[model samples]
Target: MKATPADQQELLRLQSIDTRLQQLAHKLGALPQTAPLAELAQRETAVRGTRAEAIGALEDARSELTRLESDVAVVEARIARDTDRLQHTSSVKDVQALEAELASLAKRRSDLEDQELVVMERVEDAEVVVSSIDLQRAAIESEVAELEAERDAAAGGIGVEREQTERDREVVAAGVPAELLAFYEQRRARGAGVGAALLRQRTCGGCTMTLTGSDLEQVRRSAPDDVVQCPECDRILVRTDESGL
Candidate 1:
């Protein structure tokens, strides 16, 4: 807006600071560790572990139930064979032995049936656990999807802001004189903040140090159009009305 060369340079410096501040603010707002996606990933991992344990338990229960059922079948077969032998036996001793064998097989069959029942109950419980874990895993998957969407949105928004900053930088660059722009860029690359500072109350804003009496006098006597640099920080110093010295 028709600013003097010094005022324009100051504006450019201010713009540069504002741009960096905008980027820093965005970065602070969008930290990866604190993002929703990260938390969702952690929850998904826990749910998956639980699901795996539940599945393993179910498989073990099924295996035990199978073994118990096989044992029951074997005992029943032995009881049948002993009953046939008892029917055909001629001696009282042989008959007694067959009866005893049949009784033992019956007891074994009963025991195997009880074990089978217990295994069946455990299988049912494992199935319930697996079902519960599956539901939980599904829920976590939905949350992960939502978090990924949010992360994508945040990234898209940051991209837009970066483009806007680039445009603003171009505008600021155009207003700055070529030689001055080169000088500012060089100093900025060397770690100076914007390569310019405002002089206020006889203090160099770049370094926040007050100038010596003679240097202060010299600055005051210099033409307004002349560009001056802070001795301590080597930054282009713009004189402001608030400079007391």
Candidate 2:
């Protein structure tokens, strides 16, 4: 393939813009927020599980407390009935028996009341745990939202810049010969991000590999309008005044 010296230079400029565009695409795909956002989402799920368990514990504690309260009420009722019996009894033995029964009911009620207090404490503690977990889940969700927004804005800026760069590439690519442009595009389609580069100071800019010995001699002998490719990377080497031919 052959292109004028001016066309070769335009191709290099077009390559530069295309390289920037590729880099922008890479940055957009590998946004920094991606990993952290994923981690935050996992944490949110785990914390929510903890919150669910806490809620279950709270319900269990409340149920126990209710049972204890009912037991205490029954015991107090028995004590009241026994005391009324003692007042109506005429026999000393009956009175003594009624007092003894009242003492046993009082002891039962005291034990039930104590158990109720312990369960109430557990319920309060579980409530605190649930509340703390809820706040944690909310914070993680909020952070995830913020990171997503930041990532989107960054990608949007890259999108605008890439659009502008593409416009410039189109204009520069217009000046290149059609056959040469088609060849360049084919090379790019074959997974070569760079289709062309400048040969400056005997170095291939595409691969940053300096040509030496016979390879250097061949490029040096090639005409200025001649299109050449790098032996290492197969990218077109565009000759320029700075090529040190």
Candidate 3:
């Protein structure tokens, strides 16, 4: 395919734009915050599970405390009725029985109060555990929000540049002959995004290999309008003053 020398040079510009766009896409996907954000999500899930266990422990402690309180209440009620009877009765036998029963009730109340104290401590400890887990979860959530904001900001900047680059490509591509542009596109797809390169200082710019011997002689013999492809890389070679032919 024959394209004017000027038209061929525009392919290098198009290639540069395409390369920049590819770099921008890679940068957007590789933002530093992406990995940490994913890690934070997993941490939050584990903390939630721990919080659930702590809550269950607290509930169990509270239930035990409630049972102990009820037991103490029943013991105190019995002691009160027995003391009232002792005050009214005059028989010596009844006095002894009432005194003994009062002593047993006092012992039972003391034991129940002791049990309640222990269970109350357990409840307090359980509450502390739950509170600590809540703080951990909150911290993870805060970090996640921060990272998401950073990621979004970075993506927004890249997106703006990409849009402008695409516009630039459209303008540059419009000037090329239809046949040449289509041919370049096909070569670009097969050549890793590079359809044309400058033949600079006796080197094939596409492959960065210097042309020598018959290869150099062949390119030197070609006409200015001839579409020459590199024997090594098959990319269209656009010659210029720097080609060093």
Candidate 1 vs 2: which has more lDDT: 2
TM-scores of all candidate predictions against the true structure: 0.53, 0.52, 0.54
Compared with the true structure, what per-residue lDDT tens digits does model 2 show for residues 36-62?
A: 988998898899888889999999998
Q: Cα RMSDs of all predictions?
A: 9.1, 9.0, 9.2
The alpha-carbon lDDT assigned to residue 7 of candidate 1 equals 54
Error of 2 at 74 (Å): 55
Off by over 4 Å in 1: 1-34, 157-245
Model 1 weakest lDDT span, ten residues long: 1-10
- Candidate 1 clashes between residue pairs 3 or more apart in a chain or in different chains: 201-243, 201-244
Q: How do the residues 1-245 of candidate 1 rate in per-residue lDDT, one tens digit apiece? A: 12355654555465465548567566846766346667777887888888898889999999999988888888888888888888888999999888888888888888888888898999999999989888888887887777667666767766667767677777777777776667666655554445767788888766898987778888888777777777777877777777775
Q: Give every collision pair in model 2.
A: none
List candidate 3 stretches off by more than 4 Å.
34-149
Candidate 2 positional error at 203, Å: 1.1
Alpha-carbon deviation at 98 in model 1, angstroms: 1.1
